[model samples]
Target: MSRSPSIPDRPHRDIDSDLPDDERLEALRGHYEDLVDVNDQLSEQLDDAEDRRERLREKVDRVERENETLKSSSLYIATVEDVLDDQVIVKQHGNNQEVLTDVSSRIGDRIEPGDRVAVNDSFAIQTILNTETDARAQSMEITAKPAVTYADIGGIDEQVREVREAVEQPLAEPELFDEVGIDPPSGVLLYGPPGTGKTMLAKAVANETDATFIKMAGSELVRKFIGEGSRLVRDLFEMARERQPAIIFIDEIDAIASRRTESKTSGDAEVQRTMMQLLSEMDGFEARGEVRIIAATNRFDMLDRAILRPGRFDRLIEVPEPDRDGREQILQIHTRTMNVADGVDFADLADDTDGYSGAEIESLATEAGMFAIRNDRNEVSHQDFTEALEKIEKDDSSDVISSAGYFYQ
Candidate 1:
């Protein structure tokens, strides 16, 4: 241990008796000044020493706390299986060991069956843990509303109407359904070819409503470990139930809800199990209050019949490629923010881009803008659009040729 340097003693007031009176007074004044300076130095040293002692004491306390923490037994997570008069049964996670343990009086009244509790090595309940949704499930929740809106989507008006009636109407106007004495549609399934605004439709719904939106891909539910996928599904639905008036949009749903086969493979079996849990949650014995489901898939035929039933997916809306008018509308919507020259005619462009989906029209508009930029122009022109269409057609033909070559090989 280090010790503080000792402070010097105060200077004594001493003067020669034979000195002149003025000189003696001057000597006494000098002594007084020196004593004052010495006192200030000592005071500074004392303050510094006290500060150092306090810091050291705090450090020692922190170290002692850490040491105690290290010496304490680790707490294990366990679920309360049953609660009796004097004791509670807890099954430890991972080990699956059930132990009947006495609960502390402080938390005895709070402990209940199905509650997750922290227990010590001796199986003594330490504290009750709050129910936690799986982090994976929580991440799927859309905290920020999607920027896409119904106005941004084109060529899917009827499909959008069906979706709103199935999903948004019930959430916004439950009294209407109640007045009619009928239950609202439980879920909506969007099936169509690629790039036909299926996802944008879902996003439009998400943006149009104030309800909680939880979006996830079906591939995310296909877990490698058994029971994990099903647990995740359960957690997702439970979270939706907790956050009522919630909409769950599962994109590419055919990945997990594919037709079940008798393949005896573990991977297939796990996927089937997850699908079964999803089905039960969609239309189970217990009522799913204020929860709506929306799923989209390009391969609609691949989905299982069970998931396509009336109760599970009450509305099956098909979002196909845009017609000429729809394509023109989509083109106009995409280029609304762009600088276009007078020479560009949307009607002509829409006629030229036949069989194009809404997504393709948006891409065409983007490509046209790129062409204008390449030509060092500030505004898109009809010539630019013509060049862009030619390039896209060439690329499409090349892709078809490549596929054909691969198939022949």
Candidate 2:
């Protein structure tokens, strides 16, 4: 052991008694001042020593913890298979070894089957672990509701009504369905061309309802490994069940629900398995409770016939391109906040945008605003819209030509 350094003695001063009374008094005052200075120095040293002692104590405690950890046996992850009186059967994860372990009284009441736990080499339960949810599934949950509402969406009134009836009405007014002695729609499938407000409709539903919104794409469900995709699908549905009155929006669902083929490739087989799991979850033997499913697909023809059956998707709604009226409505909605000149007529703009979808109409409005900005104008004129229309047509034609060339080559 290292010896601590000794503290130096306090300073001392002796006053001579032979001096005159005033001189003696002055000398005594000086001696008293010196003692006070020494006392202050000692107190400062003691304070510094205490600080050092605290730091050393903390260091020692950390080392002790490390030493204890090193001496402890490694704990392996396990799943509780069954729980008996005071013993529980656990299956070790990596080795698939099942063993009966005694549970302490502290955690005996809490130990249950299907729970994850940590076990030692002797199969003694150390601690119970939380049920693991797929991180990918957790990320798919929409914590913040979208700002979109029914008013924000244009040209999809009928589709919106159907979605609300299928998803929203059941959650909001279940008594009506019960009184009518009819089961509400389990799922709604929206099929339409790309950029026709299919996704926006889902957003509107999410915003309108106070239920949990979990949005995911079909391509994301197709994992690279065997069983991984199916596991993720099961986990997602389980999570939705936990958060009741939840709406699951699966976009571009054709990626996994495509028609099955005779091909025996592993990749294709895995996808088929995942789709089967999704089908089971959609309209399984067990009730889906308060959960509702909404899926959208651009390639509706590619979807499997089994998935489109009555029970899975009670309503197969087609969200087609907006008509002249819808186009005009969409234009007005998109440009509601823009600075439009008095001469700019949305009806004329709608007529010009002939076969455009709602999304295209919105894009046209944005492009017109950009054109006005380019000309250093605050208000958008009819001429700006005309120019924007021409530019979009030209770009579309160029894209068509490029695609044709690529196919021909």
Candidate 3:
């Protein structure tokens, strides 16, 4: 509902002597004013056009530079193998081809053995590349401690001790091993069924120790492309070495460390290659300075023998299901902060829950509290624990029956 713009009145001037002199002067002045307004508008439009042209010029320049880069000869990554008098031995990354190249005087003094550098088609050193660690691996280094502590865990006191001795103590007091005239244990491997507190133990170690804790899963090392997985492993270890007093925890380690197979599929081959790289990083020619290793797996039997040798994994700790006494201790630990009735007995509850892991016992305690909450009670009673246990037992039986049915079918 905008109104139509009125047409501008056409300028009129007559030279008749009958017309008033002041009116004629005013008419001329109006025409002059109209021209001035149009000139101002044109000037504004010219300024805008010039600005647009400048922006387009800049955009074109950037694109042209990018095009030049794309059309240029691609450079290859090479490592300095040796530093001779005038020339250096450079080895290409992918094909491992070695060549002797004369370094530019500008870069000759700076170049050294084991430095990564870029090479042109003529094998001339162009620029130095950083020893690249995978960005994902770099992000996995934990600076903040986990809330878990050894006191919070239950039913695996011996396993906790062994882990502390193998990982935490060595990193904290390396002089102990040296003074005793014994090479420190290299690493510890924790194996058990699900919900047996293997991962929690690692978390406890991270919480108690001052070392840089890096945690990763074995499945993360399996990559979609060739050599990518292996590269990631190398970068992870390099990151650990760079940050000494470091602890590396690999969870579900069977994904990469599984037994090497004869099958020649590309995917399987890549996994094995990644595993070999991990093995080399763990027990290569060079010594690991102050890094400690902790790994957890449910299927210990599937891991390759090379990875489980004495130098690689010095201690193999098994975290089993909680026994009767352990169940009581775990139950007590979980329920300490909860509001429970005075008549509740942890020993009686533990006797009822046979073959339950520490995690399951914790869950039972939580479920009992939830039941009391549901019933509008302030404190949990024995009946709540009984109901929770029955529910969990039913679920377990149902799972077993379904699994058996599937196998038969």
Provide TM-scores for the models: 0.65, 0.65, 0.65
Predicted structure 2, TM vs. truth? 0.65
Off by over 4 Å in 2: 1-141, 223-227, 285-288, 397-409
Q: List, residue by residue over 333-406, the lDDT tens digit for candidate 3.
A: 89989999999988999999876777778889999999999999989999999999888887774354224222
lDDT, candidate 1, 1-409, per-residue tens = 5777788887887699899999999998999899889989999898989999999999999999975874485877777999998799998765457899998778888878977777877898877876453335443646446788899988778888988887788777888887888887677888876678987887777677766777877876674323356656777788777876677888878988988777878678778877888888887722235777889887777778788777887678888768788888899999999999988899998898777767778888999999999999999999999999999898884354224222211
What's the C-alpha lDDT at position 17 in model 1?
A: 87
Off by over 4 Å in 3: 1-143, 223-227, 285-288, 397-409
Query: Each prediction's Cα lDDT score?
Result: 0.78, 0.77, 0.76
Candidate 3 matches the true fold with a TM-score of: 0.65
Worst 10 residues of 3 by lDDT: 400-409
Model 1's TM-score against the true structure = 0.65
Ordered list by lDDT, greatest first: 1, 2, 3
